[model samples]
Target: MKEMTKKIAVLGAGSWGSILASVLVENGNQVMLWTNSEEQAKELNEKHTNEHYIHDYTYPKELITTLDLKEAVTGADFVLFAIPTKVIRPVAQQLLEVLKELSIKPILIHASKGLELGTHKRLSQVITEEIPEEYRSGMVVFSGPSHAEEVANKDITLITAASQNLDNARAVQKIFMNKYLRIYTNTDVIGVEVGGAFKNIIAIGAGILHGLKYGDDAKAALMTRGLAEISRLGVALGADPSTFMGLSGVGDLIVTCTSVHSRNWRCGNQLGEGKKLDDIIQNMGMVIEGINTCKAAYELGNQLNLTLPICHAMYNVLYNDADIQEEIEKLMTRPGKSEIEKYDEC
Candidate 1:
């Protein structure tokens, strides 16, 4: 049996981070749940609860929460980064300060999605740059059809653990899977990342449909076609086509797109309801990844010169103040073409 005495540092103490922390504690590992706020750390360390981010959820009494970066990651076998995508670079930069001082190298697992906007760098690329070169490959992405709320409630869910190394992928799979969570291992890091990474863009579009009071068939078609666009981009990025069909790909897209609890979906719905982009973001105190993804995907789409009509429409609506109804009408009148292209005829 694999050793279970590992110390795992989970950054971001959100619902997803808390759920995973609970699982690690259950697995006989020492868990350090890190937070940016000292107040949140107090609640988590003293009350065994994270009422702010994860409502009605109580962490294990033994689970440690700290504001100190060095303390949170000290001697841990793995560092789980569940921070928001936009904050990833800044947070990783801060971690470098701690790492440079103490010099500990543990496997860094990122559960965040959404590509970096200006850099157009994948999350993996960002992580590699953050960690030292010799330890660069010690990275993993925990991705799949995981909804944080459901995970906090101990719901049975599936996720894919991906790394460049097959052995490391299996190790990550074994570490993350619990009775309530099933973990699969994969080697297609880019495909797995992009599958979970890019689907938020489409999920926002799904929410827009709900706000528009569209029929279920309309939503389903959008999701299917949206997946096609994502697959196209992923292929161009050197991701395996088959990865788009796996748990992290279509599975995650379906759940994120359909669920009312999805922040991205909710953000899109609010936009579709005619709220201003700035207003929607201001009201949504939580991180809605789709908006960030929209910016990055739009910029990246232009960089790659790829045709992503759905993304383009959403970007225009979110950033350019384009009329949602008008954009939908425009998409409806788009030129006809095969849904499955020769490039990615899967």
Candidate 2:
């Protein structure tokens, strides 16, 4: 059977978004990449490169770039969001108006990770709330351990496409899977989202451990306990515990924590080296999602009465200017408990 080509509109022309749009185009799909910057759009259209985000790489010439959201999404079969979590709601609101005006229903998928700052809602929840049911086919979260740089370099990578609707998940899997990239279908949307979002927090901690010149033993312990915190918060929020063992869970946690490509880990490393959070963020020139996510997780943990020590520690370091060494000492000196006394508490 011949594969049918579909039109994909990818919002946000950042590193991940541009790379994903290129992947879609390479898979024989018509892709329209939407960017807020007219300069970016012009450069992408003419030069076929996004130098600011992904340097020394060329995008597919067939991939289209547009400054107008409506123009990009007008006839797209899928509207994939690759923007930051902070801007998702506003962009979705804009999308809602466009979808209404056009009277077109496209499957909405988000490649972004992290919960909303004030509401602590998942990206999926934010999108669902902004875009009415009548304006979209279904919602899907595309996430896993893959990084933009690796994916752009054509490195072998695997990811999960998650949705409540099995058919929708399968459809996304079929669309995105190629030789260089593999896609798995998962129906546990909550688990996938939670795991994806929470892993960034642990990654930052891992970076801090490395920055402090901690040995493998300490880093290993941090990752294990961090996973515990993630799984506990996820389970409390209605995610499947076993999902943490999957690609979106432990898989993502390992990569983000260990990789040099991870912004969160890098941010944490700088904090470990005694740099101020505000200064580090200003220098990095990219959004460090884990910082904001740690804030959300801290507030959420208190509200749910969950003991998220690592998250709280990260929150203190990032927001409250708490001493990193003191926080580490605090975590180590805490009263002990059995490794698996309770499944939920773990």
Candidate 3:
């Protein structure tokens, strides 16, 4: 099939959104980057760089950015939400209102990776709830081990485009696939979403280990057990067990935990070094999804009656102000069991 040019509005002019906008523009799409901050939008349009988010990388000159919601979404072929998970609902609501005014129905793609705080709803769920059924062409989540800073520099990155609808997943795959960036499509939205959200928690723990001067042996053990914990909760919540092994699952988990580009890892590293959560967050000047994801996953695990010890340990450190070393000891001292407990019963 011949490639058709598209007009894509990428909401949230953060690092990820800006990277997506740049990629779409490179693919010959008319791209508009939307942000709430007029000053940031103006700076992007004029300077072709989002210095605050991704350092040392400049956006393509053709990439357009706007603060006007109506102008961004009007007649857009696809709307990609790359904003923080916490504000996903509000942004989706605003987009829905704009789409209603323009009478446009476009495919929705979200790259944000965190569950809602109280509701524990996936980012796609929040988008769908805010956007009326008729006005949305489809909703697909694009996730994996992608770090926006590296991706902006055209680093080799692989990501999954996941949705219940195969067509939507494939459509996203087409728009994003390039020589440097590979896109894989999957129908397991639940699994993909779970992997993307929960891995951040594990990454935080990984950072904590690094901060505490733990060795590779400790990191390896934590990652292995962490995957088990993630798979358990995900499978209990209707995700495919094998999805945890895919790019969005173990692949994402590995990268986020080890990379210096990861915000969650950086935050966790600080916490491990005895820094306060508030201080770490304030100094970082970026949204650390793991901080909130830890809380949401903890609540979700309790509700589902799943044992997520690693997640629990991280949650205790962040929310309860529990000692890091104590939580580590608690995790290390946990009773031993079969590695395949979930499947042995099956």
Candidate 4:
């Protein structure tokens, strides 16, 4: 790897953002962790702990937290979008406003996942639309199975650093890539983007099965069938089926579904156990992407005229006031279909 010194600006002080910032500073990069609250900035820069969001971890001296968007990105060599999916739009707009003076561009990496609900556009599409076209050349997505909780402690993780620019992708791959964190490169941003967003749905389903006290046998079946649904929807959207087998696909789906750390899965577990969405969110104090994603995926399937049976069942349960177990029974009692349908991208 080429010797390098860089400045990293991590937008969003959530668990993922802080963990990523810690990783950046550990790599000897100057990291400015951006937070929305001025109070959070003070806490991060002074006490080194962000109690309001990700508690218990204090940042090192090299890591500085700031609320000034421009100050954070002034000379940054790399930018990571770790904010939740919904806030990405206004946040990117904020970045564009701050970056107007810069003719020279820095590498852009999005660590966030999901599509804009209404337009059904991926985060990469939104980034390309918001940021200057000049910056588009350096855009990449660092996505995969690493959860924020595990990543903060520097546990072994693997991810995809995908870009059309092989050189730029390799640079990102090397920056956070370590013995514990393996980085894979992909030219199919569409595949990586779609896979990451879609997996959360299956994760929610996995959580439901667990919540219902279904044993490993049932959970395994749910995951396998869920992977089939994911590949089907992704391939219909022009992603390569082979990409479905890789880290951003199967690896991510498995982790999110199985891990208690997954918010989406937890949300589904609550629903399965007969709790209200409003109550669940109020208790957790964080957004559950899968709940909203269930709606998005359902609408997108209708638009595409694709038969996402699994998603359809999930949506029916979520929005139509359909009985949850009835939906499950509905799926189980369906007419027998060829087993090969699961593997084929139709």
lDDT of 3: 0.90
Best by TM-score: 2
What lDDT does candidate 1 reach at residue 210?
91
Local distance difference test scores for all models = 0.85, 0.93, 0.90, 0.83
Rank the candidate models, highest TM-score first.
2, 3, 1, 4
Clashes of 4: 0
Which residue runs does candidate 3 get wrong by more than 4 Å? Answer: 343-346
List RMSD in Å for every model shown. Answer: 1.8, 0.9, 1.4, 1.7
User: What is candidate 2's lDDT per residue for 1-346, written digit by digit as tens?
Assistant: 9998999999999989999999999999999999989999999999999998998999999999999999999888999999999999999999999999989999999999899999999999999999989999999999999899999989999999999998988888888889999999998999999999999999999999999999999999999999999999998999999999999999999999999899999998988888888898999998989888899999999999899889998888888888899999999999988888454563
Q: Which ten residues in a row have the lowest lDDT in candidate 2?
A: 337-346
| Model 1 RMSD vs true structure | 1.8
Off by over 4 Å in 2: none
Model 1 scores a TM of: 0.96
- Per-residue accuracy of model 1 over 266-296 as CA lDDT, tens digit each: 9888877877778888887788888888888
Q: Candidate order by lDDT, highest to lowest? A: 2, 3, 1, 4
Q: Pick the winner on lDDT between candidates 1 and 2.
A: 2
Tell me each candidate's TM-score.
0.96, 0.98, 0.98, 0.95
- Judged by TM-score relative to the true structure, which candidate is superior, 2 or 3? 2
Name the lDDT value of residue 211 in candidate 1.
Answer: 86
